[model samples]
Every structure is written in C-alpha cells, then in structure tokens.
Target: MTLRADAVGHAFDGEPVFSNVSLAVDPGEVVAVIGPSGAGKTTLLRFLALFERPDEGTVSFDGTDVWDAPESDRLGLRRRVGIVFQEAGLFDADVARNVEYGLRVRRPWSERLGDELAGLLGRNGTNGAVREALDLVGLADDADRSAASLSGGEAQRVSFARAVAYEPDVLLLDEPTSDLDPRNTAVIEDAVDRACDRGIGAVLATHDMNQARRVADRVAVLLDGGVIEVGPAERVFGSPDDERARKFVAGELVY
Candidate 1:
C-alpha cells in the first residue's frame, strides 16, 4: 500500500500555512519529514493522516482519494492508519486497556471474542496481540500498571503499543521521541524499525538529523511550507541540491 499526498495545500483563518506539498510513502518504507519549527511539518502530517482536508489537492491511500470517498469509506480507511502524536495521549486506564482501546473501539466483537477465547484457552489468545505490542516496546511487564503511574517514556511506549496493536497499514508519527531521553529514544526507534520490518509504511516528522540518517529510506525537507528537497537520505544529507537544505543539514540554519 502507498500513502500519498498530491500537491496538498492548507490555510487557516485567511493565513496560508503551506502549499503545493507532495510526498509519498510506499509500504515498508520509512519516510522522514524534516524541517524547521513552524515550517508546517505537523500540518503536513495531519494532511497525510487524513485528520484534515487540504484546501487544495488530495491525500490518497492505496490508490483511493480519501477526501472524495464516502464517509464509510473514509472511516474504514482511517481504521487502517494509525497516528502517534508528540504527546503520549493515553487514556485514564491501565496500560493493557490503553493498548486495547483502539482494537476494542474498532473491532468490538472481535475484541470480545478474543477475550473469551483467551479465557477459555487459558492464554492471551488473540489478545496476546496486545502483549506482543507491549513486548515490542519492552513493556510486557507493565501491562497491568496504571497508565497514570507511568513515566513519560513509559506512557509514550504505551501509546506506541496502542497504535501498533491495530497493525495499521500506515503509521503517522509527529516528533515521537523529541521529549525522550537517549535510552527511551532508542526504544522508540527500535519500535519504529519493527513496524517497517512488518511492511507498515511510516511518516515521521522530526528535527533530529541523526534519526533521519538512521531510520529514513528517503527524506523530504520542508521549508517555508514547501518541499525544497526530497530524495534518498544519503543524497539529501550528503549532497543536497538545494542550498537551504544544505544549510539546514549542516546546522548552519536554525528553524
């Protein structure tokens, strides 16, 4: 599957935030969106996530234009896309329940059946999927812990687990590890790698150039709400054709 943004533009309250921005994420590919703060990286990710309809152009998933589709189709499409915001955004529940929230809401009957089957089989059963996600983030033992009791890093891990448990076709991440320490950041980065390993496309918005180098197959540089450079990570960072992108990559330019 492919998630694509075709010449997307957006404005707010008569003020334009960005225009004519286009990018695509192929299945199993990790695309890093790097830019200065206020350059509309989050806005662009919002558009790609189908959270907002762009004022111009379209966001498509698997060859279907999301905005023009029927409501049911849009909803169904959204179910296959997951988003992880900068904040952990966990509910006031235990870790396991928080991880289960998406599946419970989107697949209520299946969730119930999974629980029932798990109990009958004296195992986690399909709900073991939740445990699997927790395990991915190294939180398998924290499943019964109260989310409110979690540290910031743990909360973020739970949030990631929640998103991954659903096995979305596309994962949209907005500065997911910005607030994390090196250890926590490494954990989150590993989770992202696992997602891509499973053929889930990822679009990560981050200011960490090191992260882009480590994780991205391709990089798109956003400047003044437009994409100024886009190509393989090596070329974009090592030999960018755009002067602005070069400065940004060299740390000579501040956002």
Candidate 2:
C-alpha cells in the first residue's frame, strides 16, 4: 500500500504552520522527513497517519481518500498504521503488557477472548508475539520488567516494540531517536531496518542528516512549512535541486 499526502496545508489561530506539502511512502520503502525544528515535520506525519485532517488537500491510502471515508473505515485504516511519538508514552505496566496492549485492543472480540482464555490456561497467551516484538528492539529479556524501571533509551525501545508488535502496514516515527545516545540510536535504527525488510512502509521525521542517509531510501526536506526537495536520498543530500535544500544540507541554514 501507498500513503500519499497531496498539497496538505495546516494553520493554527489564523497563522499557517505549513502549506502545500506533499509526499508519499511506498510499501517496503523508507522515506525520511528531515527538517529543522518547527518546520512542520510532525504536522506532516500527523496528516499521513490520519490522526489529523489537513485543512486543505487530501491524504490517500492506495488512492482512497482517508478524510472522505467513514469513521469505521478511518478506524480500520488507523489500525493498519503504527506510530511512535517523540516520547515513549508507555503506560505504568510491565514490558510484555505494554507491548500486548495494542494487539489486545485491536484484535476482534472473539480473537481477544481466545487469547484471554489461552492466558488463563497458561499457554503462550500472546507472550509469543510480545516476546517477538521485544526481541526486535533487543529487549527480549526485559519482558517481565516494569516500564518505569527502565532507562530512557530502554523505555523508547519498549515504545517501539509496542508499535512493531502490531505488524502495521505503515510505520510513522517522529524523532524517535532524538533523545537516544549512539548505541540506542543504532538499536532503533536496526529495528526500523527490520520493519522495512518486512515490507512495511515507514515515514520517519528526524533532524539527523546522517540517520536519514542510513535509513531512508528517499529523503524529503522540509523548510518554512513546505517540502523544498524530495528525491533519492543520495541525490537530495548530495545535490539537492532547491537552493534552500542545499543550504540546509550544507549546515548553512538554521531554523
């Protein structure tokens, strides 16, 4: 599936945050959104995720307009998309439960009941899925640990695991590694690679040009609330078509 945002625009209190933004994420491809702070990267991601409807333009999944769809259809579409915010946003629960939360809530009632029964009988009880997700983030052994007891990086990994556990068609990440150190950043990057290998389309909003180079198949540069350049990662970073994009890439531009 492909997620496309066509000429999206948004404003707050009569002030435009961004305008005429457009991009797309194709299945199995990773598109990195790189921009300075307050450049509307998060806003663009929100529109793509269907969490917010742009005041102008449309977000379409496989040519179906998300905003025009019914609530149930929208919800269904949302279920197929996973998002990890800037913060971990974990609940006060153990790692396994936190990771299992999305699956439990999104599964059909009968399926949920079956999993609950399996839990009561002491069978795998969704632990298999939970463990697999935790493993993906290098936290398999921390499944029983409390989320509150983990480090900042660990917490973020758990948050990522929770998103990954859903096996979504699309993954949206907003500065997931911003607060992480080098090692944790690598771990998160590896998880993203794994997701893409599984054919899940991803849109990552990050300020780190190097990370964009490593993870993105294509790069979209946002400046002053609009995408100034978008193309193959190497081309966009090495020889951007827009003068502003060139400046931004050369570290000559600052937000």
Candidate 3:
C-alpha cells in the first residue's frame, strides 16, 4: 500500500513547526528525509504514523484517510504501518516476545502465536525468520538475550526485526543508524534493501547525506519545517535546489 500526506501542517505552543508539507511514498520505494535538527522531520513522521494530528491536511494509507478515521479504526491502521524510532523500542521481555508483540496485538485470536513466532524465529531451524531479520541487521545470535544486554546498534537491529515481523505495508524509520558502527550500518542498509524487495514502502529520517545517497531512491530536504527540495537522490544531493540543502550537504552548516 502507498502512504501519502497531503498538505500537512502542524504547530506547537503557538509556534509553527510546518505547513503545507506534502509527500507520497509508493510501495517498494525507499524515501529518505534529510535536514538539520528541528526541521520537523520527526514531526512529519509522527503525523504519518498517526501518532500526532496535523492541524491541516490528511494522511492516507492505501487510499484511506487514516487520520480522519475513528480511534477504533486507527488501531487496525497501525497494524499495517510500523515505526522504528531513533531510540530502540525493545521491551524488557525476551527477544522473541518483543518481536511477537505486534503479531499478538493484531491477532489476539490466534492460539498458536507463541509457537508460530518461535518457529518463525527459527527456534527449531537454522534460518528462523526472526533470526534472519536479526542477521540482516547483524545480530545473528542474540535471540534469548535480554534487550538491555544489547549495544545501541544491536538493539536497533532488534527493533527492526520487531517491525519487520509485523509485515507492514509502510515502514517508518527515524535515525535508524544513528548509533551504529560501520558493520551494523551496512546491516541496516541491507535490511532497507530487503524491505523494498518485499514491496514495503519506507520513509527514513537521517542526518547522514552519504547514507541517503547510498540507500534513498528519492530524497527530500526539509528546512524550517518545510520541504525545500525533493527529487531523485542523486540529483537532490548532487545539485541541491536550496541553500539549506547545499550548506548542510557540504558540511558548512551544523544544525
């Protein structure tokens, strides 16, 4: 399913964060959001995920108005949309339990959820689906380990697994590789590719221009809480349309 925000706008405490922001993400496409801090990247993502309401505009998922739906309907909408926050979102429970949380939440009637997730995690086989997700993020052998036991990178990978386990149509990522080493970064990069292969639309927010160049099929540069330029990744980075994008991409501005 495709996710889109039409003429989105938001404000907080009488201050305008963003207005008239519009973007669409098609299934199997990877879109990267790049901008300095306080550029409304997080706000926009939260709006798309239906975590926050935009004062104006609408968020549509698969041609349905997700934000305009009732609270009861939003829960089902969330099942098809998964979010990976900058801070790893693992729980204190076991690794398998954390990944199975979304599945159980959406399908409470399933009696074999535990066994199903265990099998999916590859508890009995060498290629458990959970393990594959972890492996994709370079945490190949940490199933039974506690969430607190993982490093920043490992925890992030686990969070990725949890999101992937839901088989969402739209995957939203916020600074997914902010605290990772080179190897783990590569794992995240690969995971993004795999998600696209599975026809999952993705929107990633990052400060890393190089990473965006490597992964984003399309890039949107935000400044002062509005999209200054959005285009093919190569063109956006190689020939920025605005000074904010140019300065940030060139490392002249730090925000």
Count of residue pairs whose backbone atoms collide, per candidate: 0, 0, 1
- lDDT (10s digit) by residue, model 2, range 113-195: 66566567452467788899999999999988999999999999999988878688899999999999999999999999998
At residue 112, candidate 2 shows an lDDT of 51
Task: Write one digit per residue (lDDT tens) for candidate 1, span 1-255.
Answer: 899999988898989888899999998999999999988999998888788899999899878999889998898888878889999989898898899886656545444566566457542444687899999999999888999999999899999989888788999999999999999899999999998999999999999999999999999999977999999999999999999999999999964
Expressed as tens digits, the lDDT of each residue in 90-116 for candidate 3 is 899777667666655644424345566
Error of 1 at 21 (Å): 0.7
Which run of 10 residues does model 2 get worst, by summed lDDT? 106-115
Model 3 regions lying over 4 Å from their true place? 107-129
Task: Report how far residue 105 has shifted in candidate 1, in Å.
Answer: 2.2
Give the clashing pairs for model 1.
Answer: none
Candidate 1 stretches with Cα past 4 Å from truth are 110-126
Superposed Cα deviation of residue 135, candidate 2 (Å): 0.8
Local error of candidate 2 at residue 13 (angstroms): 0.9
Scored by Cα lDDT, where does model 1 land?
A: 0.89
